[model samples]
Target chain A: MPSEFTSTLNSSTLEAGQTQLKIDGLQLNFGGVAALYNISLEVKQSEILAIIGPNGAGKTSLLNCISGLYHPQRGKITYFNSSEHEMTHMKPHQIAQLGVARSFQNIELFRHMTVLDNLLSGCHIHMKTDLFSSMLYWGKAQREHIQFRRFVEDIIDLLEIEAIRYQTVGSLSYGLQKRVEMGRALAMRPSLLLLDEPMAGMNSEEKEDMARFVLDINEEHGVTIVLIEHDMGVVMDISDRIAVLNFGQKIGEGTPDEVRRNPVVIEAYLGEEHSPYPLRSKL
Target chain B: MISGIFHSTYEQDMALRHTHAQKIRLAILIVFLLVFPFLANRYYLTLANQIGIAVIGAIGLNILVGYTGQISLGQGGFMAVGAYTAGILTARMGMPWWASTLVACFVTAGVGAAFGLPSLRLKGLYLAIATLAAQEIILWVVTHWKAVTGGVDALVVPNPELFGIRMNTDFNFYWLVWALVILVTFASVNLFRTRFGRAFIAIRDQDIAASVMGVDLFKYKLLAFAISSFWVGLAGALTAHYRSIVTWERFTIDVSVLYLAMIIIGGLGKITGSYLGAIFMTLLPAVLSNLGRVVKGVFPGVEGIIPFIQQATFGLVIILFLILEPEGLNKIWKNIKDYFRLWPFSY
Candidate 1:
């Protein structure tokens, strides 16, 4: 069913330079079933791009592919960071080193580590000193560690996670854990950040706060964001451009207003009771 | 203010300690270790030697399980390899003690690698079973190889010498073992701060995650096994030389279990805990033996009440500790110290 939705987007030719990520003709299959089929889309720099779809829509899979967790069998993922084109087919840490970072759908914070330590792990790829210096506690390693800590502390302060900084990540509340995950992603100093359902289980108030943080990150920090979200209201409010997926395929791509009136999206969400144009007012 | 302290350049922060209190404590510990053999009686000296040998084995096991997070039950087997090599080279071939010790360490390391090859494909319980098999095989070879190992006949180990001074006395052997234990413990402490140490911890926490983070698991795991085996082998060599005999029965599955028990009784991933655990477990039997003697002196029929009471006590102690304090005796020590440190405000 989702394969049919993605087939529609596969027919469109992707435009370049406007977005940092230009994914063209991406196809991924698990056994006999296609989890993602010919999904092509672009994410512009300094803009919040939302990928919205119903359950089992392969939204998380797209983020996983971009983060190098799962490599697509077909199609290319070309990302531009600081004017250099880089491929996402490399190792996850390699992608991170190239200034692209991602948070997981489920929280993957190092549970035993303190909140500060979890944030510190994100900076592991950027650490310059090797084992020798670390073991001996030599001058170079000390200086590099201090420098990185300062950078991490700045992000920690921005996220307002100072209260629980010393507490283990396992002890944190769900909303705080999500914020810590974001802080970890920010610690990489990423140019492109992919967030997989940042507010998946949050209360309405928590979602509002998260949406504010997301907006602040894009508008103030000028970081490119590609988020997979289920809440239509939040997606409609925050996203600069929206892409809708059904099953594993991209069914619609346009501005929020344009996607709102799309016939296929209407049918996918509310069944065939209402026409695509009236669903905008219903939303 | 707390952040400022932790914000020291990585080198400064990771430095074993920054305060004069720590320096003084270490100095006092060194002094105590140096004076212990002289002050203690022959029985205490022997107990110290056993603890020292166990400390060495614990350090080796720590490299595999603590630093690398790989479970291994083959340390006792590696120790057997070292013991047999030392026993054969010195007693049969008439090799110099130092040269034979070196050869024993290297040979055992090679044998350890042979067992480690299978570790490349296995992990957790499966890897543990593989090491368990190695333990059995090594014991079999040592017991059956009559020409070199003396088979069932215990191989007599010559008294080790340095500059023509025979290390035959309990005091002399105690010093040798203690010095080696201290050296190994210090080295292991430094090892954990290194890149290899981080790689091991990363693998332990999450292997797939570590691989994605640019760590080559197979290469590092093998390296961990080799280094662990080398140290364990050295302990075995020392053990053989210390006892002045090589008996296959001593390096049995029971000894392997004891080593695992020591690490578990210590904190799983800490160097200090390993040494502390080794000392505690090694001294336990001696303490129990003395207690048994006292009980027998007090009551004539007590020995008849339970023939294998010590063995039962050992198993019970391990179970009790595992249930009540899974973090082991090190946590208890830490808690006591913390309580003292914050005496007035202690919980």
Candidate 2:
């Protein structure tokens, strides 16, 4: 088997609105600089959770930590799946095999490959045939590939990227590229999807389209979403719960309604009179 | 639109040949391959045989370089492993040629995997240099290992026989060479249609992203190296038996560079590209000599410069293609196909 993530997972642990991932005392450092400090957070199953903060607030670093890109020096990240696997020490692919998929802050679509190919590449885990079976490309391998192609087609349709499915990702516009990245991540059939600044560098209409897709991915597909967005209006509108970070520390985390009134989040964004790090926002 | 081509079912969409023209093209190709040996002279057959051998090695190289995006300069060294293995088994161990060839494949795969171990830490140019080091190391070992390898001397390969028929001639060996070439090429073409192929491309494009999508980097990288060298080893065994000699000198670093050149000119990431590149690169010197002969009558004094000019032309051609159309001959073939697919109608 191609290690398709689903077959190995415990199905019962995928219930929406339950605590899916838990991070405790997470700390990351780059020499003298601390990227994340004493960060404790919980992502509930199926809910849209947004991590919002100023630039250098460790929002991306948190996603990187969960995705196993950047290993934290201290902490425990537990993926509450059918089986409990410690995320903190696992390799990136191992964490990914746990049904955890992510998109990059900057779009990382395979520039040379077509949109369809990029999505199919995401189906690496599902198509588990040996070199012999694959080289023959008959019966089981063919069936599995067609099955996954159908699944990827749904993502292409959902994201409305059918027009450019055969086009190379390099030729796609920024908005379409981001959508393709989301589509690629979704092709893994993830239990938890980490989207890093998906709406960055987009017009309002593009942002609106992305917001709908994020909502659809959560509600329709029942996938848990952890979003990082700087557009406060979109974040406030879409996120069920929000976590605020500043200088690698968790300042506040609550429902968007609750987070909007938090003094710490406000102070982090619009700084105190003498603080030089005033963040630009529409919150 | 490609006229009269419509797929109502997923099975049709997943087919290797979906269109009537593609099936027809394949039929034509098969027919041509079958008939070529009869029409060509011994010299042309020799050239064709070289293409067949180079095609096998080039396809293997493509798997490592183009698909998996791992640059290996030790391909020649891996081939030497196959050549020596074939030489030892058929000559020393008294094994059959068929058995020796099969054994060489597995043995070479093992050696390639050992060399590929450093790939986890090294990448790009570093990996290339490491593989180069492996080439030098393998050559050194082959040169020094007197008992096992006969040490820097040529070992005569026994004639390959099928059902008590000793096939000693290049014409006789042409059947074995082309059969394996076609088989390996078929496998290579089909490989990309499956998940492993996609995984290789994914790794090539972005190893980090490929890993995050749940591809085991270590497994696939080693598999690429192993499988690639496995075929190259098969080619080596064939070469040893065909020439009726095995010496480590033939499988030099120069052969590896030539194989790289074949894939580059054929185009990266396409199976058909390997065929084009291999045939073109293998026959390029012959074509150049023919051109040089014609130019000799026009300029009598420049006979010594022909080899220099040929080398320069190869470099110039590669540079021009790299600058003008980096995708190579396969892309040109694709463009021509596209034109015909929409014949009498502009897109």
Candidate 3:
């Protein structure tokens, strides 16, 4: 059973197999160089979907487009929760306010802030105290602050980061910083969470921990997760669905078993003899 | 090294002062501040007033430069706006000092926000250059617009009267200024405990991530400018009344650099650092001149060198502080406290 803190994170949950995010015929370019082209994808509610691709394959670009960090020149991205939110033209912060939270590929944390404060920052949209009230921090401001502090504590507890909660994020280990980044995203209470290269630098043990947290957040908390990962073993073991990209184009996408058997995915990515990923049979 | 703090409630845990010792020490400090003017003479009272005003201004700049990581060199211009607004309101219209000061803060805040608009596109050195333009433009307006500002003639400010009591003396102004300092300190310290404070620091560290986390870059950046300028404006208003005059010469670019030096040498992003830096920067010249008197007594041929020595010392000390400890005196003080805190239990 989920704790009270964990259960209250998402205000609403979608039924399984419902379309949480729909991206149709999206195209992005940088001064004539295409970063992504003709990409169409759908993320189901309460499922772990992993995007696997080589470097420069536009995996991170797609996540950025969805989070409103990058503007795709063409097509539309729709996020459906309580209602449909046309996310293409909205500013990054406006998208975040509509319950879309993302962790960066390079661990974009408030490095000088304490881990607890970094997580509280993720609760920015939820916090409602005005500037004048914040200056006099007593009454409603103090009440709101303490209430959110309690909310962030649950994320800290779930991520098993209570030991370093008061330490600066910059001073933490790389693996720990990645965990804190996830904790920060979790603090946002997002119904749709996007993760870019979440396990890029983590060791096997840390990757297992992160994978478990992702699955738990998806299954227990009912958050729809779309992640980009390179490790085939972890992706094949954990993800409910997988999407493959090559040279800024989607080549194949399916359940792990189907993607593993797809001739195109095998030819373009998986068939490389000196691949970084362990053999599929090893998984 | 100090332990044994247990909070039974979240409010207790979130308190600015965590321990009974902290509360008791704060009480003693407050009592001492109230009684300081009584113990000191006029010279010390004057110095106290200067430090008090500097504290407010330095804390304001720290909010912009130190906490928000937006470098602004137009502090002098913002202060000028505050002084002139207060000066014009009081001397020309017969407005109350309190109301004028309040109006001055708002006017300066508006001006500061207008200048901060450039920050939405510029950063680092480019932003610094843009804010320097703000300083130049405001100074030019004050200098060229002779009709309103009195240009070269300057504006004479009358002493403020509160409850029929004239606040013309250094002793009276010391209490008034220090009271505001205390209030500003509490407000800034409290500001950091909330989401606004967190968002400012987050923007400083990583702006893109802050935006993705739902912090509006433009709004928070401008809000920082407005709030920071408000306090600086308050300091300028107090300075006008305390000096009984307002002049464009007083709000020069050098004054802006001095405030920046205060925050840098005291400690960036720290409230206590602002206090320490203000006291240190304000007293450096006085202390240097006192030392100069002894030097002149020994050799009466070095009077011209003494003024140059004071300026050189300021630059030298700032460079030395940066090289030795960029965290400023706050970190050094913490190191000392930690050493004593764990004394005789060396591990």
Candidate 4:
């Protein structure tokens, strides 16, 4: 496993992970209530896979299960970086070490750490493991850090957060904090990135900026991203494929056009009584 | 004229010192530290030595509680391990101060890691309680163990000799204590510039988020414990040699509270704050005691009231500081420096 991971890591450009993220028969529970039940979907590699659902539709829960945050009682989540790997049973850090990075629904930026420091933390797996490196940081640690900092600086430039790069994350406005959050996840240089409502509590301008960043990260970096979002219009615009969930079960899964026209998907978004036309028009 | 540093590269941008003014200020500070021993009397030198020991131990505690966000009141316990180990090695087995201190550091770190093992299973107030339990256990062991520690009796430490030069005098010891203080401070300041320090901060902020970012929560938490204990242990070994004795009572729960107070009053997470907080806290008691003596002499009928007044003053100072500047002395220092940098236009 280590050799295979190293082989994939040594390559300068990402030239792999071109298989589907197959989530089959995923079941999670909190006490007795089911969070997700019998959920299955496939996210094609290098595509923006957006999971859309109502408030309690288990969108974030599915992402949690996929990213190995929540261990489900039943089901398997499989991904391919260069070869098939089981992620459902892995620890969150182990999954992340395999180049799967994620951001939280609520901003989880290290509030005390500076923006630069938070992003530096995103490269945790890439750094040397010895505590001595940090104790005497002028040698190997400093060299490796300056190298990663250059990469983080590029990300800062890309996210348009350079002016506030040295500021504490807690001091930033909500919109700016969200941008930094995305930048931190991107700093991992992950082959697969997961975002949970990247644009939550954002103004129109902030939402547009976040959307563009998502698009750029996908197109330019060629990173396979799975995002959980509520904004139907934004989800419809960027998603190469859409998976809709309702009450712990997947109701519909397809491309934007296919999911948009599907009766089940429309019904899930609206109600059984309401017509799907108004929702489609809103999108 | 150059108004500020113009960083030409990313490394320069992240360098610890960005300006000539900072370099100049640091230089002056270094000179002052070097010259301090000659200027001060023996009493003041001993007080300075106390501050030096407190500074190192406080930095260690700061790393665990401040940077890693793990609350630990077992600092004195770890320090006891170091002090006892150093005492046994140097006084009993006839080892050198440097070698014994180094060995004591590793021993204390191991004990500290053992206690920190439960940190992964506990957090916040629970973790604090667990470490508090560790402190109690360590203290119990140190008190009961007789032959090695001399039990309740003092285990005398011979004067540390570097190249056969005796360091019993406060003037000589001053150089050694302050020098270790400098090295520890330097290493700690550099710690945050690298990934390990950043990861610790991340774990402190949000463990789940840090895990998703690829930081091993278990490893970093334990590492935080070990690293912090190493510093406290080193301080312990130094104190053993400096005081020329090791006793179990010297490392009681009160010492742990004092160390925590140093970190809190200095600043929770900042290195400079820890140093300043140590200085401020270590001297505050002495200053209060002197003030109390003056009050007692003036009032004539307040023999029992002086200690109470000292206690009240300590609590009052902490409360006032927490209310006015909760960020600690580091924030105050930063504000002062910023104001000076902005000059006449300062807001």
Candidate 3 residue lDDT tens string, B219-334: 99999999999999999999888888999998999999999999999999999999999999999999999999999989899977999999999899999999999999889888
Model 2: runs farther than 4 Å from truth? A1-12, A270-283, B1-5, B294-299
The numbered model that scores best in TM-score is 3
Better of 1 and 3 by lDDT: 3
Of the two candidates 2 and 4, the one with more favorable lDDT, higher being better, is 2
TM-score per candidate for chain A alone: 0.87, 0.91, 0.93, 0.89
**Best first by DockQ, ranked:** 3, 4, 2, 1
Q: Can you give the TM-score per candidate against the true fold?
A: 0.82, 0.94, 0.97, 0.94
Chain B TM-score of every predicted model = 0.94, 0.96, 0.97, 0.97
The regions of model 3 sitting more than 4 angstroms off are A1-6, A272-283, B1-4
Task: Give the DockQ (C-alpha) for candidate 3.
Answer: 0.85
Best by DockQ: 3
Residue-wise lDDT of candidate 4 within B1-347, one digit each (tens)? 24655788877888889887799999999999988898999989999999999999999999999999999988888899999999999999999989999999999999999999999989999998999999999988888888677788889899898887888579898899898999998888888777778888888899899999888889889888898999999999999999888999899998888899889999998899888999999899899888878888888988788888888889898899889999999999999988888687745
Clashing pairs in 1: A6-A249, A6-A250, A19-A44, A131-B195, A142-B9, A142-B10, A142-B11
DockQ of each: 0.20, 0.74, 0.85, 0.76
Cα lDDT listed for each candidate: 0.78, 0.87, 0.90, 0.85
Which 10 consecutive positions of candidate 2 chain B have the poorest summed lDDT?
B1-10
